[model samples]
Target: MNNPPSGGAGPDLSVTIAGIRFRNPVIAASGTFGYGREYQGLLDVSALGGICTKGLTLRPRPGNTGNRIHETPSGILNSIGLENPGIPAFLEKELPALRELGPVVIANLSGADPEEYAEGARILGASSIDMIELNISCPNVKAGGMAFGLDPEMAASVVGPVRRAAGGKPLMVKLSPNAPDLAAVARACVDAGADALSLVNTFKAMAIDIYRRKPVFDMVSAGLSGPAIRPIALRMVWELGNALELPLIGVGGIAGPEDALEFLLAGAAAVQVGSATFAHPAAMLETIRGIRDYMEKGAFLTVGELSIRQKSPRARDRSGNTGSPPQGG
Candidate 1:
């Protein structure tokens, strides 16, 4: 299983996104997998399709204070506040070792302003990382703390500058589910030069501390993720798939192979496993093997063949509509 199964021995689990090849479609979501080294002794990190590094900012952050995580029904609420070692430290300390792990490396960059994002993208573009995932969930300091991903215009303002600064490297914008018009934001990003998109970053949710009669997190609201959000996340991927031509990486509450298959069938080129890893360290590897088993049983030669659209393209788009020529993976 270390090497992709030989021809005729098994189904091909490989997928290509933004021209970068992956051994399989299961990638470790950012923030959950750290810098890829933390899970080295836990599972075969190289078996993954890719690794999205922990969120990086223009400078080191102390992160949020007080209780930062709380458990809820079927999910977890987190307010980690993007604590990271910044770009310079990642380039000097983490990346060399991460690159050796074999999986494609994606730097998950976030910032408080357009210039900050552009500067980070410029630095990362000049480095050896394989791709850059823009985490647009960071609150826009100049916009009175509204997340840049919340509005189409705001999302484009930052994406345009970062796209230019990214120096043409594969750029994927991580979309927030909290947006009033997710389709509009996706369109804006594509128009602003994004090569690919990974969606439903995290739903804006909250939890209560009943005993204290207050919010469980210091920020009052935190991100909700886990099996709880999988259904909504899958619907989002399907909707976007019908409406757009670019590749999408579906993420939200994927916990197992069954969950991963749902995203693939819904039209995601790849899938990311997040909180599930904390409980099951080998969840991603299990998902990869599970998908391979599924494909083999179904006699599917490629992951794309698993899409529902392949079976009934018109079913997905009632208007018989499509947009742009497909690009990226």
Candidate 2:
């Protein structure tokens, strides 16, 4: 038998975020892909728009002591505590290999305070990394973790200096779902200096071991992610898209193309795959293929085309009601 349609490139999957063009809109999220080294020999790294490295700090961290990750009904709660080998090691060890392997490399930087954030950005910007993702939304740590992300002023305090430090490179701020006002916080980051925004980082969660009579994680609380947060993430993306004019990346619990499509239609410039990678090593590659197949079937030529189709007037409010103009006004 002849080749049974293994499939080749079908449509133009390229997407641009903050003036950076990615081969596809599906990018590997930080803290999950491990600096693009783990996925080596498993999938084409270059096929992705970019790779967001595990959240990096100024110094190496030992991470949480006790139980780290726990599987829930439809999601995973993690207390990894931003475990990383620090920025110096990443530059000296991981950056070269990733650059050689291809794909746009985005460095995810985190710090306990604004100074640390600026310093890390200043250092990473000097490297070959194509972009910097300021992970201000991490909820696992106790110090300045989500504290800097929840309030608009606090978000700006971290973003302004980092953006100035990373003047030459794209500086994207990752938004926290724990914030009382995600849209206001997003605006603050942009007004302060962020080049792009990524929304709906894992929700705050905790799991108790009833048999053990204690918390499952040493940190007492963890970040909940996976399919469980998809609906919330999608709603935020749609609202944030309506609020902000800059490029927004949708993330939370995307496991497949259908989830990504919701984000795209809601106004995301791209989607980041996180927890699903743990279950399937080739999840991102599969997502890319599925997206291409969906586009081809729908006769869609570009991601922008697909995104536009869903930007109609049928948008609903948080109450699940159509948001029509006021009749009395």
Candidate 3:
């Protein structure tokens, strides 16, 4: 995967998330990428830096009934509730095929309790998988989703056991933006020994069906994602980046390379292509190329050279201090 193009058009797009390195910052978000085999027919899977598998659980889950997804203005609302074939099935069927892609395979695991998380983590940890993303922020699930992610204690409990189970393999705790103070939860995960963090998972939202005189989905609430949530995700990334020194993966509402750049500028070491993947299967690849183009145009040497801080006149005071600009100068 490191075979670069002939000319040195720009710096390599490959970036490191946690301690594991990726070919590029473009990763197919969990739930959207399925098992990574489906896209094999459409594009080269090896071209991607990583693939985050659908949210897995200790036991198989059928997810919710009725309409699981709905389209909105500039986004989509999903109440899929994390339906998956369980970790055992994923390892048995999905793992072998994904291994052939020659990129990092990040298993996204969710649980109703800490023990369940540990069990899933241990099972996947023993495998050839590159990492495990603890999805504690599925807003659609009633018991084990965003609830566990909202409380710092619960988040730590869930991540701590998984970290132990991972036993040195990278463990990334995916956080919810709906939480009052995402930084607090991020700090807790860091304290619990998480290798890295992915922030602004998804925000809880709803859509009504006027013609049907009821809610669009059976669950009445869904996780909102896509361009609409970019600002929220950016703010969370900035907050968490400032609060903790740990590597961050920004996820919410990233559609193109510019959006990815915003997250990087907000302190994300890398980013995941989530809902945008649903609309454009080639989105991740395009994002990778776009970032490369951006770097070359800006005369940047590496993704690491991009600062997270906003570069504005207001950012500098009259005395050129790093603090806020002088008042009414």
Ranked by lDDT, top first: 1, 2, 3
- Model 3 per-residue lDDT tens digits across residues 4-116: 22245557676766668787777889989898888877776788889999999989999999998899998999999889999999889889999898779999999998999
Model 2 error, position 281 (Å)? 1.3
Stretches off by above 4 angstroms in model 1 are 1-8, 138-146, 310-329
RMSD, candidate 3, Å: 6.1
Give the TM-score comparing model 2 with the true structure, all chains together. Answer: 0.91
Over 160-259, each residue of candidate 2 has an lDDT whose tens digit, in order, gives 9998888789888899999998888998998998878898788999999999999999889999999999999998988887786677889989998888
How badly does each model clash, as a count of residue pairs?
A: 0, 0, 1
Error of 3 at 234 (Å): 0.6
Instruction: List ranges where model 3 is wrong by over 4 Å.
Output: 1-9, 310-329
lDDT of 1 by residue, 1-329 (tens): 23332335666677778778788899999999999999888887887899999999888877888787788899988888888999999999999999999999999998878998899999999999999999886431222123889899999998999999989689999998888989999999999988889987878888888899998877888888898999999999999988887789999899889999999888888999999999998888888888888887787877766776644333322112231222222
| Lowest summed lDDT window (length 10), candidate 2 | 320-329
